[model samples]
Target: MPNRLALKRKSAYLAQLGRCYYCGLPMWQDDLDSFSRAHNIKPSQAKPLKCTAEHLEARQDGGLDTAQNIVAACWSCNQRRHKRKKAPAPDAYLDLVQQRVRKGRWHCAPLLTAFGALFAGHDSGGEATS
Candidate 1:
């Protein structure tokens, strides 16, 4: 059988329709090589767009790995959240990501522009607030 976390991640990915829950970008659930080829980016560049299981309530703070608590996020957004000294709540973080993604400040790689071309129709309006 597949690993539980992987299944959960896949479930979340599908639930989100392959979109990153945080940044609202397209993500690769598996096969970085394929993702790289599809996006025409290097493996290093593609790594940030891989799908990951995100905890709406962090595990460290007693959040369980149940489906209700899990959501799919991109590797970049996942890291961006945990990298903070104090990770913000999911809704708050979502707002922050929306702001940055709207202004195209969340991701700067040209590869993301190419990736966006593959899966268009994301409208992140408004400005990024401090």
Candidate 2:
């Protein structure tokens, strides 16, 4: 059974990423809908991870389900990754974070207006009275 958190996390991550990590292309909405949750860290033998409907990675141990843990992958890359034993690296994850931060860059126009008000003449309502 797929965890609700995993499914949600996968959706959020893919939406945030907006592109497939392996393919380096924007993911289509339909393709994104098809993305399955993938884990970066494998769970222990005593506590086996639950699998989803599309596919499962026995070696991955299925611990990773968070935004940082997963990536947007096409069907081919998803299958290729399943054959691997270890989780993908943090570079892609880090890049996503950096991209997000960059996307939120400060717009200085408002700040400049506020600062200019401090130096310029203005009424109590902050507009030129006369």
Candidate 3:
């Protein structure tokens, strides 16, 4: 049987439609290996841009390991939260994430634009530039 953490994470991921609960970014299920499990108060070893399990309240602060306290988040967002000296209330942190998402501040967009520009002038055929 799967552990409770795994079960909760899976449930949250499915319930949220694979979206990062904080930033509202899409977490692709096709690339499951790239996702991470992040805690509100603890940093995850997993790399960024992956789906992570975020705790609405830190376990150290007497938070329960129930589904209500868990959410799906991207690794980057989760890491940012972990850096906080004092974790903000879940509601406040969520509001901040929503604000950032609305502002289009997530990392993926700019990287995509840059890659597009870099390849825009290149031909698929093997041709050497003068």
Candidate 4:
């Protein structure tokens, strides 16, 4: 049987439709090799591109480890978020992400651009922000 954390992660991933909550980047389930090669990192060290269970209210702040409090996030966003002295509330963070997206500050533009070729004609209106 899968562990609770693994189960939660899976649930969050599906709930978010495999997209990074912060950046809207598609977290491809089967792109480990491509992600590793692109970053020139070993698979073991490529967690940034992997989906992680992120706490809306960080555990250190007395957040419960419950489904309602968790969301799927990319490793990069998770790491960057934790670096801040205070974790922002989920709504605030999401607002910031939307603002960034509208300002053409997408964090994973290159990857999306590459994937764009294969997924031609399915634009997500990302370019309008630029």
**Best candidate according to TM-score:** 1
lDDT agreement with native, every candidate: 0.79, 0.35, 0.61, 0.67
| lDDT per residue as tens, model 1, 24-74 | 777897699998887678888878888889998999999999999998888
Clashes of 2: 0
What's the C-alpha lDDT at position 100 in model 1?
Answer: 73
lDDT of 3 by residue, 6-102 (tens): 7897788888766567665555433444443222111223235476778888788888889998887777878888789988887787788666555
For candidate 1, the 10 contiguous residues with the lowest summed lDDT are 121-130
Misplaced by over 4 Å in model 3 are: 29-47, 111-130
TM-score of each: 0.84, 0.33, 0.67, 0.71
Itemize residue pairs with steric clashes in candidate 4. Answer: none
Ranking the candidates on TM-score from highest down gives 1, 4, 3, 2
Instruction: Between candidates 2 and 3, name the one with more favorable lDDT.
Output: 3
For candidate 2, which ten residues in a row score worst on lDDT?
45-54
Off by over 4 Å in 4: 29-31, 34-47, 115-130
What are the candidates' C-alpha RMSDs? 4.8, 18.5, 12.4, 5.4
Which is the winner by TM-score between candidate 1 and candidate 4?
A: 1
Better candidate by lDDT, 1 or 2: 1
Q: Write out the backbone clash pairs for model 3.
A: none
lDDT of 4 by residue, 1-130 (tens): 9778778878888876676777666564558888778645566655555888888888888987799888888787778778888777777777776566555564555554544342333222122221
Q: How far in Å is the alpha carbon of 2 misplaced in model 1?
A: 1.7
